[model samples]
Target: MIDGLVGGRLYGEAQIRTGQNGKRFVTCKVRATTNDGDTIFVNVIAFDDEVQTALLALSDADSVALSGALTPKVWTDKNGLIKPAVDMVAHKVLVGYRGES
Candidate 1:
């Protein structure tokens, strides 16, 4: 995994869920713009309570910065087409990055 920062607007409300093993985690989706002017969505997960608290206070309008390790993901579409994507497991997150948005 490579370290990176993903900056973009929060896509929706950050969700807090408990894993089957009883560990709580937070997840947020970010809509990052590509160099080609297109958009790719990334789902960032935070297992740290401090980071989760920070993410909980931010709104979807906020510009966020996620510092973490990049991960690759693959899924099969409804049409049975294989698609690839990138996700980040954020160790640190800077929420409400923009003063106001």
Candidate 2:
């Protein structure tokens, strides 16, 4: 597990799910660009109330930055292409300004 920050656009609208213990959490996917010009997907889950609220308010493709625990992973696409990915236990969520000037 690595502690770091990731910035990207939300791949889809965030979803809320209830745990087996009846606890609710938010989950979302972020598509980040790698240094090598590749795309890396990050699966983010937020348990904190503030983080969850921030994530739930954003729409698909919204710019976002998150800080938390990151776990590197590899996933295979439908075409059998291997892609890099990460699982993030997000503790903080940063969103772009939404209010009018």
Candidate 3:
């Protein structure tokens, strides 16, 4: 688990959904632009209500700073194609703030 501040822009509407066990959480994608001009989408999740509340305040135009666990994920896409992706479970999320570091 890596802990660092990664800055990115919200790519879509973050949705709050309930898990099988009835726990609520939020999920969305943050698009980070690399120095090479390529974009990387990081799937960000917040499993707690307070964090969820914070994440849901912003929209696609806002930038965010994410802090938590970063990991890789693999799943089948709409075309049934196997894809590999990166994800982060955010314990904290800050919006409308420039990455001042």
Candidate 4:
């Protein structure tokens, strides 16, 4: 597992779900742009109470930065092209206040 920080815009609204063990957690996707203009999606999950609360307050397209464990992944697109992605177990969440007065 790679520990890193990723900043991006929320791809969709975060979801809260319960596990079979009766534990609740949050999950969300972030669309991050590469320096070369490519877009990579990060699947994020947070179990910490603070992180979960911060994610739940965010909306789609909201800017956020997260720090935690990252796992590299690859997925095939509709055109059969393989794209890279990351799965993050986020421990910290930072929501950007851009465009807010």
Among these predicted structures, which one has the highest lDDT? 4
* Maximum-TM-score candidate: 2
Question: When superposed on Cα atoms, how far off is each prediction in RMSD?
Answer: 2.9, 0.9, 4.6, 1.6
TM-score of 2: 0.96
Task: Report the Cα lDDT for residue 93, model 2.
Answer: 84
lDDT of 3: 0.82
> How many backbone clashes can be found in candidate 4?
0
- Residue range 50-100, candidate 1, lDDT tens digits: 889888888885788889999878777799978666799999887654456
Stretches of candidate 2 above 4 Å error?
none
Ranking by lDDT: 4, 2, 1, 3
The TM-score of candidate 3 is 0.78
lDDT of 4 by residue, 1-101 (tens): 89999999999899999999999999999999999999999999999999999999998999999999999999999999999999999999888655766
Cα RMSD, model 2: 0.9
Q: Rate the local accuracy (lDDT) of all candidates.
A: 0.85, 0.95, 0.82, 0.96
**TM-score comparison, 2 vs 4, better candidate:** 2
**Candidate 2 residue lDDT tens string, 1-101:** 89999999999899999999999999999999989888899999999999999999899999999999999999999999998899999999889967887
User: Can you give the TM-score per candidate against the true fold?
Assistant: 0.81, 0.96, 0.78, 0.94
Compare candidates 1 and 2 on lDDT and give the better one. Answer: 2
lDDT of 3 by residue, 1-101 (tens): 87756688888889998889988889988888878876677898899677798788888858888888988678787999776556998988777645576
Better of 2 and 4 by lDDT: 4
Runs of candidate 4 with Cα error greater than 4 angstroms are 98-101
Between prediction 1 and prediction 3, the one with superior lDDT is 1
